[model samples]
Target chain A: MVFLSFVNCMRVKGPDKFWKRRQILKLAAHFYGRKRNCYSIAIRSVQKALQHAAYGRKVKKLERINLWKERITAACEELNIPYPLLMENLARCDIALSKKTLADLAIWEPRTFKCLTQIAAAKNQSYPPTVKAALQPPPEGVITRGML
Target chain B: MNRPISTYKRVQQWAVFGRLWFLFDAKWQNPFDSAEKIAKYLAGKHKPIYHPLSDVGDHVVVINTKDIALPNKEWRYRMYYHHTGFAGGSSWTSAWELHNKDQTKVLWKAVYKACGGSLLRHNMMERLHLFPDDKIPQELMENISDHMKQLRPVPKALHEYTEEEIKNFPKVFEWPEDYVLN
Candidate 1:
């Protein structure tokens, strides 16, 4: 059956659909011995394999942010603090932590993240009684600050 | 301890690049223990060539922005701000926001704030680069070989992590866990 397709099939899936020619050659080299069939059915097969690898990278990128979010949420949850609270305190303190960096710490350096939570908690606790209201100050405050 | 600013032959050009070194003080304490020390260390002022008015500063690069340590309660209280020219435009951003929002700018602000804001300071800052984490683009690495005398080998773990490792770490989910649960 495979032999019949090779002989009779008019459909010659152009290499362009697979990838750039250079990439196709790389795939071909990895799959079959580098020199034997530089361009053939074997090369096409290798291109398919290469396409799969590319997909794996794409999938990983899509999920990277999600994983970081999970790590941060986990760290926050364990500390009895929600992610939003931790973020708010940091913002209130003018502590700049990139999401990428925070996500990284939340995973690989939990100790550091715990310290961050402690800091935020301390900041929150140190606040005067009208704390929750301060997060989003009244329109009056906004007017005074913005227009008045 | 003053030394003339050293120059290395330029091998490549880059719009951005950063370098970090793990260093210990004479007493063996982490020199990076305080932001002041870190500011001094990166400023190259410890060297004899350190001059206040001259552009003798090295184009220091810093990685691991997140791993940087702070003394006592500094992290909790440090507030960053932005000006909008209007009276109410003075909005405060935190160190965390600066670090997380666009960390490169945070490093820029930190360095500028440390160096005593001046026109010359901007020139010095143009050379300093910071990444949120330790990763640098491959193209930047190619240019660095031209100007640097000593180059640190990129860590092996960084190569393996490639945004893929984040997915593999063990995960456990449980309900009834907290204040806000959906």
Candidate 2:
């Protein structure tokens, strides 16, 4: 229907109120008791639930990253390397492995991870004194431009 | 097609998660450092599929515990504390004294500590087989398919070098023939 005047248009609402409440109720379908059926309660719970859902998505990613770091740290410790040093040196060496992939290799492809650690270790000498004391001298063939 | 794919996946799971038996030679190795490495294998940390919740740890057979070397004076300074739970039952035993009482106890304790105080510690410890000498039971020996490398190379004692090897070693200069005896 067309509005006859500006006053008539001002008095009109955009859509039927039923559809809007139905949207919120549909989201609250799994909510408990009155929250699932009553519009007033359902809308509140639905908004809260949606907020939690959004926050949870971000937290889930952060938790996974923390877990990957934990796994990588454990694996690096086994090779007598620090976790930060391994990550920093890996970047310095231009080996662009993500924490998830690095953690995966540490578990399933341990030999490959060990080789990566050796490459990182070879890049630094006399620094990270623990590496010097713990690891044997880097094999003869490894070459790097020192601290360019 | 589904049946074949499912069967292949099943076999792949087994291959990826199969448990392994590892041999560790503790001869001339520092027990503390060796324990850290041994604990990794025992807890299945060396496996890419390792998860704290998963029961994927492997068996470890450690031999020659009697020869484990303690750095510095740890053998004398280190103490093993024990408590019998009775009044005045607590006692501290020096590392050397404990080693004398039981050759395997030192390395055993080292590994136990290295494995951490997790709930699975006992389960992991159960899989550890310790022998004072290199003599492992035939049953255990048959299962060892891999060896854990020692943390440090075993240093060769002067006496261990063959006369030919010692003679062939390069010297800056031969001791002067006229050098007087001490």
lDDT of 2 at B14: 89
Encode model 2's per-residue lDDT on B1-182: one tens digit a residue: 44555888789888768888999999999999999888888898775566778888999999999999999999999999999999999999999999999999999999999999899999999999999999999999899999988888888899999999999999998778999869
Per-model TM-score of chain A alone? 0.46, 0.78
Write out the backbone clash pairs for model 2: A107-B47, A107-B48, A108-B48
Off by over 4 Å in 2: A1-63, A70-86, A89-97, A101-148, B1-7
| Candidate 2: tens digits of C-alpha lDDT, residues A109-132 | 889999888788775443444645
lDDT of 1 by residue, B94-166 (tens): 7666656774554456556776656666666665556657676775555443222122233456557757676
Cα RMSD (Å) between model 1 and the true structure?
26.8
